[model samples]
Target: MKDRKYNTTEKQQTRKTIQRNVNSEKINSKENKANNEKVLDNKKILIISLVVVVTFITILIVTGVFDSGVQQNVTQMNTESQNSTVNMANMQEINNLENKIAANPEDMESTLHLAHLLQDSGLFEKAVTNYKNYLIKNPANADARVDMAICYYNLNDYNTAIAEMENALKYQPKHQIAHLNLGIVNLTARNMEASKEWFKKTVEIDPNSDAGKRAQELLTSH
Candidate 1:
């Protein structure tokens, strides 16, 4: 009887050990499952955050905020390229005219052409030299004198511009362009009264001409 009881007690202890191990495994499995779910939730949150960032960038692209700047840069580049091309062509023409005039120093036509080109190219001193050369033989050319006056005006020599314009008027008393340009030059030189007088003369010359209409506008505004 004592041996049987001892065996039964040993068996009971073994069963209790088994039961404890099974319960510990259940708790560990529950903890593992919870940890996996937490990891999945974190991954989902990260994916959603990435999606939000991508969507925001897409919206910005669609709104033209980025495209406008790119278009403006392209437009500016194209304009600069066109201006450079035009300058190159003008320089070539100037060189050709210079060569022609050098071969025939008395070529007043080439001299005037070169002067016009140089004035347009903003070489005021060189243009003045060519204009003086042309005027020495063609002093009665009111148009040429007016053009030279414009060169002086651009050089900021307001007094010389005025005198040149007046000389042009001496050749062509009704030179509307000369009068209008004198008004512009006087305005730049801060001689408002002289500017107004020139503008009035321009209008009196021909009220329907472009220069006269421009002078009229200036008189009304100033």
Candidate 2:
């Protein structure tokens, strides 16, 4: 009876141990499934983060604000450069004009321009020389003779100025400038009668001109 009772108790204990082992394996499988779910969630979050970063970068590119700023900077630089080039071109043109005048000493137009430049610079002696050279080369030029007379008058050589006016008059007696300049020279030299005669002649030459009207006023005034 005691042996039978011991065998029955041992069999029950072994069956209980096997049941505990089966329950342990089921618990381990549940834990593994939870860990796999967590890993899957992490992979999904990583993919979402990558997509967000790529989309943000794409948005920045699509806005084109950065490109506009770059374009504006380039345009501003180009405009400044073009302005500088224009300024340089203007300076070169001025230099070229000066060079042309210097290279052609005997050119009538250049000589005239140089004389005016010298006069403007207060270089009276050089201005006179240039005007005299022009006159010598272009003796038939009535306007140049008048210009020379003006230069001589500026140099205080009234007698030579009057002589030039007389020479211009010989070419065309009705020349208004010649008459007006002669009248002015005579008045400066204190020859009242000669001044009167030339002023009257200027009025007769061009009654519609300002010089003629002024000459008429001077003739009547005194």
Candidate 3:
């Protein structure tokens, strides 16, 4: 009987030992699963952060925030090229006009045309030379004389401009444009009284004319 009791007790102790070992393994498995899930979550967060950074950079590019400087440079270069081409064309036309005038010194029509063209092109000194030559032959041309005076005004020779405009008036008194231009020149020269007088005369000459209306406006404003 004692031997049987001892064997039974030993078997029970061995079963308890095995049961405890199984429970310990179950707990270890639970802990290992939780640790693996945490690692996966961290990896997901890292991937999402990388995606957000890349998306922000792409948006900046698409919105032109980084490309504005390049666009400006391209636009400026195109404008410069166009302006250069236009200047070259204008210079060519001027050269042709000079050649024509040089070939025929006595062609008054061509000479006057060249003078007007040169004045339009802002070659004031050269235009004055041509105008002087033309006026010597056609001194009674009030229009051309006024135009030459305007060139003198542009050249800032106020005294000469005033003198030439007066000469135009002597040829054609009551010339509205000459009067208006004299007003303009006098105003630029700070001769307020002379400017007012000329403006008044321009209006008195012909109130319905363009120059007269312009003169009236100047008188009212100034």
Candidate 4:
């Protein structure tokens, strides 16, 4: 009986050892599966991040926003360069005309050209001087008289402007430009009635002329 009791105790100890081993195996398996799932989630997150970065880069390239901005800057620079070049050329031409007038004081063409250039450059006093010198040589030149009148008007000499314009009309009664210039001078002097009369005369003389069109526009505006 003693031997049988010892054998039974040994068998019970063996069974407990086997059960402990099985439980340890099940816990290890659960741990391994959880680790694998975490690794898969990390890989998916990495892939999504890479895709978003690539898509953003592609959108920037496809839209051409950066390229268009560069092109616009280049075009603006080119336009400024061209304008500078043209201004330099115009100044050189003005210098040449001035030299011509200085050497030959009797050069009517050079005087007229310089006067026009000075007027365009806003040098009203210099333009008036040249115009007056040209007029002294050919007093009956209605166009030159009108040009001088415009110069006088720019110089704020309202009376001189009006007199010169009226003198231009004396040379040619149907001088549309003279009439238009007279109207403009009178308007500047606040003589609305006189201005209207000159404008009316300009329209009646030549309805299809540019001066007539300007007169009509002024009449309608007033």
Candidate 5:
């Protein structure tokens, strides 16, 4: 009976030991599972943070590029608008000049005025046509010839401009404006020596004249 009781006690202790081990194992398993979940959560947070940072950087880059393009487009549009306004004003003035010419084709004064206006407005080709017509009516108008030479110079016809200026000098030997303009044209053509000579001639023509003052300035600059 004592042996049987000792065996039963040993069996009970063994079962108790087994139960303790199983409980400990279950607790360890739960802890390990919780730890794994925490690690996974940390990894997910890191991945989300990287994605947010990359997306923000990309947005900044795209926004900067868009702003620069918008600014350039705005500047170009303003420039075009300003140019259009100026062109409209020039066209109106040209239309008025044409109307006057149409009304009185034989009026040399109006014709010459239109030519001068056209020249001042940078319409060199039209100015040249009108100037040629004026010269046809008044062949010996040295001033008109000089004005035509200026149109030629503006048109980049340097040789023809020089020839026309020389013809003006033939008609009026001491024309101060013609001499000054010759100096200017030669200076533009990079003929420094000829420019100096013409400027000197301008000064000699009339020291107190506006043309003379301009010539003196050019000479001083050189």
Candidate 6:
């Protein structure tokens, strides 16, 4: 028997079977490698997501974004303390004012009242000093100016008294007392024209005023 000769069909069938087995094995190995790689990728993604979430939470805590509530409480406490201090100071000052007003010589009451008492006691300069002090603190005190003008009147400083009275009247246009008093002070200085004008205004503004009655009394003498 000559060496058995393989036919083309048999040779081809053999090659096909070998090639199929090799291809099948290559396909299985590639599938296993791909599955392993996919699992690794999934694990890496999960770890990265966890890290990002944790970092975001840490940043929020560190930046004081979470401390707003605590800061508000502290602010409220400070404000309350300031208000308490102010209220205490006001109470103390008001109490002192009441005590000061109830006493004598050194007692400071209404600017007008204190100055009037000192003037009546014949301390012209001292009365003037007190009125000046009062005016310094309460410059718009009309009642105090009236008393100050009277003090000047007693000092025979008719010009000063008239000026102070005019300042008082400027604040109170309808001040019947101011008009009447100004008229008399003008009369003593023989400012007849000014006195007549003031007396006429006093009569028109408040005919029932003591100043008006005083003017009428003076008229009867004239």
Which prediction has the highest lDDT against the true structure?
Answer: 1
lDDT of 6: 0.79
Model 6 lDDT per residue over 103-208, tens place: 5434545544556656766667767987887787677777788888988999999999999999998788888888888988999999988988888888888677
Q: Lowest lDDT 10-mer window, candidate 3? A: 86-95
| Residue range with the least summed lDDT across 10 consecutive positions in model 4 | 83-92
Q: Give Cα distance to truth, residue 72, candidate 1, Å.
A: 3.4
Write down the TM-score of every candidate: 0.77, 0.53, 0.67, 0.65, 0.58, 0.49
- Go through the candidates in order and give the C-alpha RMSD of each one to the true structure: 4.4, 16.2, 6.1, 6.6, 6.7, 18.7
lDDT of 3 by residue, 1-222 (tens): 999999999999999999999989999899999999999999999999999999998998999977987888999999999988877876787788778878988888887888887888788888899999999999999989998998999999999999999999999997999999999999999999999999999999999999999999999999
Model 6 weakest 10-residue run by lDDT: 103-112
In terms of TM-score, which candidate is strongest? 1
Candidate 5 wrong stretches, greater than 4 Å: 1-87
lDDT per residue, candidate 5, 35-151, as tens digits? 999999999999999999999989977889767788889999999999889878878877887898899888888789889878878889999999999999998899999999998
* Local distance difference test, each candidate: 0.95, 0.82, 0.92, 0.90, 0.92, 0.79
Which residue pairs come into collision in candidate 6? none
TM-score of 1: 0.77
| Per-residue alpha-carbon lDDT of candidate 2 for residues 92-195, written as tens digits (9 for 90 to 100) | 65456458867876577877776666665555677778778877877777776777787788888899989988987777767798899899988988989999
Candidate 2 structure, TM-score to reference = 0.53
Per-residue lDDT, model 2, residue 177, is 86
Tens-digit lDDT string for candidate 1 (99-208)? 99889999999999999999988999999999999999999999999999999988889999999999999999988999999999999999999999999999999999
Q: Local error of candidate 5 at 49, Å?
A: 24
Q: Per-residue lDDT for 202 in model 2?
A: 93
Task: Tell me the spans in candidate 4 whose CA falls farther than 4 Å from its real position.
Answer: 1-83
Off by over 4 Å in 1: 1-65
